[model samples]
Target: MDNQKDKILVVDDETSIRRILETRLSMIGYEVVSASDGEEALNIFRKEYPSLIILDIMMPKLDGYGVCQELRKESDVPIIMLTALGDVSDRITGLELGADDYIIKPFSPKELEARIRSVLRRVDKISINSSIPSSGIINIGFLKVDTNKKQVYKNNERVRLTGMEFSLLELLVSKAGEAFSRASILQEVWGYTPERHVDTRVVDVHISRLRAKLEEDPGNPDLILTARGIGYLFQKIMTSN
Candidate 1:
């Protein structure tokens, strides 16, 4: 028996939902562990070290936002927020807290499963590709992006970035000065086509997060620039005498 099955931590306050997910995900070959509330979720996470987390937003003793924030402090594990709140602001809040993605309540099981697979695939791809040799380092201003190590540094000090964040940066940096539209970025980075009515503000949220970490003045970013009417682009590094 292979012990390498991807472990998933399902955190929801609803017992039925937990049972359903456990059964469904287990049938699909994942090892599913669950917690009924936010605090227990954290405890289980520490012990299980799951490959992914499907976290519900509303719960007692803490909340999904708290869990996501705590996890981001140490782990870059993929998080997909499940929530009853359908407001765009609520979704943005989850994304801002480092959640990799989100799904609203009454979601189709198939859609949720697909999302799970997509997030996991991204994680696997990043892990495998980071081990391969590539362009060593890209210097942009005071920042150093080490492609080989999948790490970044600012003024020789290490900068913490989630795997997804690094992937986004790599995409833009790979084609510096090339403007990538939000739709293209979604296709290239998230491996999905945006639905006509689906809010693609996720891309903007992530870009903001990246700028907060990478730019000296996030309000007026110098490295990652907005390509007015398009989307965004990485500014070519400028050399000063």
Candidate 2:
């Protein structure tokens, strides 16, 4: 495709699913490439360097989880897994493997499009935030966040965060001590509507991921705090350095 929009790599063993997504996503302005198997998907991914990937869990040669693990070793590109398994454990496995999102099979085209736009929007928002001069720094003790560089450093050592994890951290730290409800967080962070009835556990999952990356003690985080009945909050607010 010869389009200016961010490219999407869609990986599925099912030809029909790939064709449907390719047609629908292209209709909404995303430049899309479809792969019939995981091996081909990885080949195209390396060559095309797509902005995002829509990977299916079951495929020939290699599975989506393996593909995700492989890709994460080299890049932090956004990933959204496609799965027929609706079990919570399967979804958790995908998230733990660094996927940004997941959609079950038989998903609505509109919902899928919304998810694609949402992921891209988060990436673009980070870019925009990074461009602002005075709003770039957040230093709390030994933890330093540079929104301009899209980086985090703890005790002077660089910390690696996936795209979704970084977005969640940025949202909380940008407004320190402010408690955000799970529903509000879902809407703001993941671009989910209340009407969509999205699982709020997605928010919980990301929070756990962020804690693992940024906290000195993931079990008892001092920075990102639980608000009990409300939601979650960034407890400290040191002046931007």
lDDT, residue 205, candidate 1? 89
Q: lDDT of each prediction vs. the true structure?
A: 0.85, 0.84
TM-score of 2: 0.91
**By TM-score, how accurate is candidate 1?**
0.90
Error of 2 at 108 (Å): 0.6
What lDDT is obtained when candidate 1 is compared to the true structure?
0.85
Q: Which residue pairs clash in candidate 1?
A: none
Best by lDDT: 1
The number of residue pairs in model 1 that clash at the backbone is 0
Over the stretch 73-128, how does candidate 1's per-residue lDDT look in tens digits?
98999899999996789888999999988888988888898888877776555433
Tens digit per residue, CA lDDT, model 2, 45-125: 999999999999989999999999999888999998998986778877888888898888888978888898888788667
Give the runs in model 1 whose Cα sits over 4 Å from its true position. 1-4, 126-135, 196-198, 238-241
